[model samples]
Target: MTYDLYIGDRMFSSWSLRGWLMFERFGIPARTQPVGLYSGTMKQDLEPLAPARLVPVMRTPEGTVIGDTLAMAETLAERHPDAGFWPVDPEARALARWLVAEMHSGFTALRGDCPMQLHSGYTDFTPSDAVCADLARIEELWSLARTRHGPEGPWLFGAYSLADVFYAPVAARIAGYGLPVGDRAAAYVARHLADPAFRRWRALGLTKSYDPMPYAMAVTHGPWPGPAPRKARAVDTGPSENTACPFSGKPVADFLELDGRVFGFCNPACRDKTVNDPEAWPAFMALL
Candidate 1:
């Protein structure tokens, strides 16, 4: 059964990222709906899921509405035990839970000072003493998790878990604001930036442009901290490479040009998604 996930703008909604990662990383099927967080339609949009006045609300397949990210995580874990949302080892699992809880309840200073934004990095941004303290606590928890259970893999538990899902936006905050972190912490942030899912999310977010962009700061901006997306342009001709759509194997209906190469999609929707960020799609990238 597919779930209905209500979320806000991907570029600025930190909690939405956590909720999305819980489903996306775990292979859960969810149909996501956008709530206008900035356009002032959030209340009306979320009215159907009454009392859930926040972004990242989840409506289960059975018609149960869940509001909080923690509740959603636990419910999904209970429903899909084999998905490995939590660590397999009992001790590691406990630590992961603690980390997720802390992330949900703490880190107010960092969250307030450095709102998550994926478009570009701020070169001139500076962290306050409170923000620094929050970063230190985060590093301590991350270090403990990685050293104890994630010695092999790049994730906190040696594999993707709820901890990584919860902290994905924190990584974005560190990278976007150019927050000072130790080598180990910096490397962890780099890992998140390099992740395919994370890249795709950021790419999708970049598709929409904001006027007077949310969380706008006077600081100088630089290129995002990861691989840049290929610029896509529309062309009247069909794909120069593949005859079939990369996603559905359907006949090409729309075309996009990237780096002097043309790509065909089954529909305008698919074409538009790729045109905004050609590198986000693994299937399309594999064609190169």
Candidate 2:
């Protein structure tokens, strides 16, 4: 059975990204319903899911509405035992829960100052003292997780777990705003930005237009080196056929040349995914 996921604008709604990942990355089937995060209809959009008036709200197949990222995560974990939402190891599981909880409640400065914008990266954005402190705490938690279960993979708990889901948007904020994170954290952010699920979400987000622009900063370092095709503005004269994003069917101004064929995607994440797995390109094209 498919679950109902209510989400806000993908490009800016950090929690929405986390909620989408809970199903997209896992085996859970979910049908997403877009909520008007910027259209001044969030209140009306969330009438059915009352008492939990927030983006990324989830209604179970059985019609149980769940709010809050942490609570939703826990509920999904409880419902799907074999999904591996949490780490398998006892210690890693406990620590992963701790990380998710911290991210949900803590890091006010970083959350407020550097909102998640997948458009472009700020070249020389400076972090406030509070933001810096939050980054340090984040690194500390990541380091601890790596030291414990990192012998397996690049993810926080070795495998893709809820810890990664919770921090994925935080990673986006760091990379998008060009926050001064250490090498380890920077690497983690890179990984999150490169995930295919994130790519699909971002590509779809590109199809949406924002009025007045959400997070317009005066001191933008530059367009974040994200999947957005604007970075490829220099190559405007690509093949005519490759002018559409393969994932979302949107017009792509910028495209990537892969293996004798030009492939265009709305963002770098989609291009990277197709480049890394050329075999999957046909499936994505079929969707378009």
Choose the strongest candidate by lDDT: 1
Q: Give the poorly placed runs of model 1, Cα more than 4 Å off.
A: 236-240, 248-250
**Alpha-carbon RMSD, each predicted model:** 1.7, 5.4
- Model 2, stretches more than 4 Å misplaced? 227-282, 285-288
Model 2 TM-score?
0.82
Listed in order, each prediction's TM-score against the native is 0.94, 0.82
**Residue 93 shift from truth in candidate 2, angstroms:** 0.3
Clashing pairs in 2: 120-223, 120-224, 121-223, 121-224, 123-221, 227-267, 227-268
Per-residue lDDT over 174-223 for candidate 1, one digit per residue giving the tens place of the 0 to 100 score: 99999999999999999999887887777667667899799999999998
